[model samples]
Target: MQKAYKRLMAATIVSFSFGLNHQVSAQSDTYQVVSTSYQKPITTFETYIGNKKIETVRYAFGNAQYINDGVMYGSETDRVVDLKNSKQTVKRLAPAPGQIRKYKDAYYVMSLEDMDHSSLTKYTLDFKKVGKTKKFTGYGRHLILIDNKAYVLADHMKGYNYSIKLHTFDTKSFATLHHETITSMLFAYHMRQVGSQLKIYGIRPEHEEKLTVLSYDVKKQRNVKTMTTNQYVKGGVEKTQTLTKETELIFNQDRMYEINHKTKQVRVLYDSKDDLVDYAYDAKTKTYHVLEEITKTAEFRVKTLNSHFKPIAEYRLKKSDSVSPFRVL
Candidate 1:
């Protein structure tokens, strides 16, 4: 057990003979690695937005969470109160459907597909006379509407695929934005924006030893930068490393994110290790917190970061998950 500004961590997840498959690749210090002393099965996160606790919501895998525009219409008898006018409306949804999210006054749901490459299943409340449907061949479901054109992360090479933005709602128009693959010595990874220009970290399947942490924007029409993860010797091998930005929230493979329109940037402000990273924030906080767990020893670590990506402070948490949402309002 040692600590360094940078060190190689023996990867605890995979250990096998290197002579088997070259896909696992070499283990080295070039790629960034997170200390796995904090390994745990992460489940949920909560978001605090604005200066009010009444404006916050706890989010999990399948729960219909609220948004600034309006509360998610989860139940057929769900209630919504318009804060601007103090008016209320009772909403209904059929089939008790999937996760509903409201953004900018519209309700949308994530219609997940299996990517079998033949047909697609779309989750929609108004599906009678379908306007259009596009096929995306990525690992999960991704679709967003900006300026009226429907963008979908769709079909491409099995492992090399990135995102496909289809121009839905047009009869003659097809896939407007093609597949932008992750082509580099680093390998392919599932990355989302963790901060304006930094903090993109996730569990990398391609890298065997170290975790993948990209200091770029994945939502940008194109990848901002091409950063490589710590190299694992070709095949199944294990190494250990320091808690770099790449390893801070390695357990949160599916970290939630949002685009800050004011700065035209994306931010990954939540994680699974603690409620502080998962909690919401007002625009003025200018600071974010994250948790790195050492499940092997039953100890937890909390990190505080200013808006400029500086580690302002660190806190030692009791080995418990009882930290409540910080009601700073």
Candidate 2:
């Protein structure tokens, strides 16, 4: 290919055996600021899914917990501040640093210091007080979340060496999810259900640089590399790469890929530090709110993206500004 000059936007050709790498729509939608705050060793935000904080709740963890607690990708202490205005009083577990998420007349908490010294956890309200929550010893480095039924993402962990295994169960009388292993380190994860699907997105990459904005698809138990193309010459020469008709580093190493259940097209989105990746949508208000990384800060700028993935309402949330990325209802 000659004259390959794709500056930034994600443009692709056809669907590959792996999957389609989508770009943020160029048109601006709508995104209204539900709320904003800044208070942590790292810059992170949270927003409710509803109008009032009581009706909805948003909680984000600090960066320091990533390494110490191993919550997400950082070891920051498990410090959760209820940015909600609801009557639900979040009771702290103890000096261990944990909060019981409460919202919409429901409640739950990420208890257990360590479940087999493995497993990954999120920060969502734990509703069902299910059956015996067994802390499977030697689990994996993945967070486990059970919806109405008993479906767990058996999080495997080995000092940050993570591997994932999926499991399911029938909703019976009671369930108890727990961790069996406990070290001097702190651990806390959240979970819940939203809409028709269970959406899971993590900003932490395998050591940051390892899993850059890239998509790795598994088809038929094979590590299928879709969206990747190969070149063949009359001389029987062949070369393979994840480039379109034109080759460019359009996709970052830390990109997040989501397959549209409707379009069946694999769309890529990311919450990272690369200049090419950004996201903003008003599932709450502004119809659509966009975020761009500042040149010299950890804050994501606020903006509105059009239907074509273009910016509309623009506002910069400096490193000092703590704005939640997206709301989970």
Candidate 3:
């Protein structure tokens, strides 16, 4: 009995010593900061994972922003910083990173280049490699991801003229869905989800009169090429509402119109004239918010509209030179 008790005590001491040694080595690895004259200026930023410091990273530039959950993502040179596990995981992404966006359960980093071709790499939340989509010709700086699809707009050389190329892909499986060439519009600037549809607004090829909006129904899998004519086109919507859905409300510089897509009927919703400073739409509230600048009295006014394009209420704000009193929802 005495010999058995001594063996048990000796085994416990060995296990405790091994654990202590492992903890000391991990601490030394995590807390070590390398300093050198060749290194750039280091900035210390705090990242918290449930009230605990997961990791610290030294970078030349880039501010970390929350992507989703408690994970924070930022870019520095050719690497991506994942702040977690009480240590910073620096993963090599690309040489020239363009933009980083989170979609579904993965993160995509676009790589920009001087040549006509570019690449996009996909990674897991912990910076694990998923896959890459490459060989995109003249891929621009804009990317739009809706649902499980990613739309990439690129400028391709079409004989003597340049045409905008739209490429659609399934984000989950990374498969090509559609590729269409738009000859009417020069480039697209903004894209959004409008009433279960994807809409792209951009400047026209002429670049003269006004911006144009192209409505695409990706759900139907109709990736047809839409060519614009002077009168009316099936897929194009003018700056004004030539045709719209019953629930679709259109807003331009100072006027708002409700449009009928099939009948090509446009009805006036609201007209604020030149007083319209900015406008926004809230998907949750299903309302249109507008800000109007009263130039004569140097005052600002705000108003909200319901789904029927009727004004609910208006409020005037006090004037202050230090701050512009216009707010867009």
- The better candidate by TM-score, 1 or 3, is 3
Poorly placed runs, candidate 1 (over 4 Å): 1-62, 65-109, 114-130, 139-141, 144-177, 183-224, 229-277, 285-329
lDDT for every model?
Answer: 0.33, 0.32, 0.55
| Per-prediction backbone clash count | 29, 76, 6
Which of the numbered candidates is closest to the native, going by highest TM-score? 3
Q: Per-residue CA lDDT of candidate 2, range 245-288, in tens?
A: 23211222233333332232444432345442333334433243
TM-score of each: 0.37, 0.41, 0.47
Query: Can you give the lDDT of residue 327 in candidate 1?
Result: 18
Candidate 1: residue 215 lDDT (0-100): 44
- In terms of lDDT, the poorest run of 10 residues in model 2 is 231-240
Model 1: weakest 10-residue lDDT segment is 28-37
Taking all chains together, the TM-score of candidate 3 against the true structure is 0.47
Q: Could you give the C-alpha RMSD of every candidate to the true structure, in order shown?
A: 16.7, 14.1, 21.1
Output the worst ten-in-a-row residue range by lDDT, candidate 3. Answer: 29-38
